[model samples]
Target: MWSLWGLLLCEALLPIVVISVQVLSKVGDTVLLVAECPPGFQVREAIWRSLWPSEELLATLFRGSLETLYHSRFLGRVQLHSNLSLELGPLKTGDSGNFSVLMVDTGGQTWTQTLNLKVYGAVPKPMVQVFTAATEEAQPPNTCQIFLSCWAPNMSDITYSWRREGTINVDVELHSLFSNGQVLSVSLGLGDKDVAYTCIASNPVSWDMATVIPWESCHHESASGKASYKDVLLVVIPISLFLILAGLFGAWHHGPCSGTNYLSVPDDF
Candidate 1:
């Protein structure tokens, strides 16, 4: 049977044995791994190691000193703090994996902790492009088929989602060609001119969005380089009124309305 004092001591030490920590970081960013020491425990030396994707020794730190020696792939990108914590910066995808740290206390007791790091690239600004599908001719009268594609240039590991008017989800009846929401197929009628959609591109680290109106895009494409009758009227009406006013001004200045007397008084009078 275990005594009460022994059980209490075991309970206090249980939390520090083989601890695991998780860290999240983005590409070109920095992350810190803390070496948590138990209360009243004095560390004499600390050794940090990378344990996954081919094991390698990282760095070592000594107590009471701010200097540390880094090795292998962590030469210029790593720093060890005075309290046995590690700081790594300007991170890359290759830096993701399991890391471990071992600390030997002044009494020769060892403590170990494991850290799991995950790195992700920031999601770029997405662009939504609209196209009028060739199947419009086969569709019902006064209806159009529009195809929309969303993309983030030079980015990967991203998922796409769509919303209408920036709030509501896309209708269930609409067809989505890709499971990742990269392409959307929309069928619109004449009454759906006000419909608009936004595409959101996201990754674990960041997200971006772009918006497009399928009807407006398709209409603009069909009307390219051709002026509407209403637009022509707006331009012609203004110019016609200006021309009429200019003609009246010219007649008043140069016609019989001029102040010059046509007949001269007789010299004899």
Candidate 2:
């Protein structure tokens, strides 16, 4: 009867539970995750696991001591802290997942919580891309509009923004609904030909920027490959000079006057 009464009393009192989240870690870095417990409830044991790639055991702790790290992949890479929190070092893309913590308190009360880990490469230098253009004849001077997009490869959840630099007073209108005007589809005047626009790509961890001048972006590739008159003249002039000098040297060395020697004149007093 006493044992039954003690079991009932134990069931009535449950340890308070706390869960933590929003842990962000970059690739090739360490991330610390804590499984917190309320006061009066001592952490007796804990088990860390994941369901992101089916069932997998990460590590375990007993009485604040590391009991085992069951997964071979995490054998040398995992550390169990005194508070039963887990520290994963040198993170990789494969480390992203939904992880769970199963904690048992001293009173035999158990608590569970899950967190999502996202690991990604640092943001790359963004590239600004131009999509369309209009000539001055088609539109009024400085009324030519172009579309621009900022791209950072392999990055997710990025926030994009666009701003113009220069005194052309160009209009940049952001798309209202979706990306909050990250992409610019606007027009600029002929007087704005030298103006540059910058695109910014950002996330919770980092940001990158790229700049573009609309008037030059379209012709950038084509103009680079074509030879100019100045280049042709530079090549032709040097070769022409070499040929002329060679002809003069040959005439001096082998011409009619080459072998002719003047008769010696007697010295007159």
Candidate 3:
């Protein structure tokens, strides 16, 4: 009998624990927070309130009628579904906080749940700029040093990562190019082609990416090709000048048999 009394006393003083749920949302997006209760707990009334930024009662739903009353800043932007879930929409950064739903069953048992909302703005598109590092005349043969810097302007709390789609060979390891935080330093060969690199900017809510091909922007011409072009210009210029001079000489002196002029100046007179 003493054991039974002690067990009853322990049950009477048991503390209620509210379950916490985490939620992520982007700005200008709608989110639904469902009020979860026990399966057999017939809820007679449920009250939803904001617990952060300031404590305020947002809405209440009764059993018989499906009516809901909104409060404060959530007047037109909050709605209730048939399942006692709250639909909050077009969320702003200020809407990030804790919300609680209290459900009272018909037998007077109360269940509370807290939803932690984290609202973040979508990540902006990253811009990548490539810079060529100047090298001395005594530098390594066929080596081109470059730096690719990735950034998103006017953004805070953003993460940056990189993705390389092509290969780089400088007699060095591939991981050596990634030591400079958001700036990737790569030593590529002059003949390297199709080397594309992408920069990824991300937040908890969204991500954006930008790609750049450094090889294509730094184009090269072969020494043999340049020499051949110079040789062609040298052979063509003199020939062109000679043809122009011959045309002028032919216009100035005409053959005697061509007979467009008569030089019989008064000889018969």
The lDDT of each candidate is 0.75, 0.68, 0.73
Worst window of 10 by summed lDDT in candidate 2: 260-269
User: Which residue pairs does candidate 2 place in steric collision?
Assistant: 142-188, 142-189, 142-190
Error of 1 at 16 (Å): 9.3
RMSD of each: 15.1, 12.8, 14.3
User: Which ranges in model 3 have alpha carbons more than 4 Å from their true place?
Assistant: 1-15, 66-68, 136-139, 167-181, 216-269
Candidates sorted by TM-score, best first: 3, 1, 2
Off by over 4 Å in 2: 1-20, 136-138, 166-183, 190-194, 218-269
Cα lDDT of model 1 by residue, 1-269, tens digit: 13223323433564446789998889899899998977887876667778887576666655355444545676789888777788888898788899988776667566788999988888888988898876445679867788889999998788888777733554633565675689888887787788788889998888999988789876776575256756888999998787776666655655665567433322332
TM-score of each: 0.66, 0.64, 0.68
Stretches of candidate 1 exceeding 4 Å from the true structure:
1-16, 37-41, 136-138, 166-177, 220-269
In angstroms, give how far residue 152 of model 2 lies from its true place. Answer: 1.9
Model 3 residue 96 lDDT score: 91
Instruction: Evaluate model 1: give its TM-score.
Output: 0.66
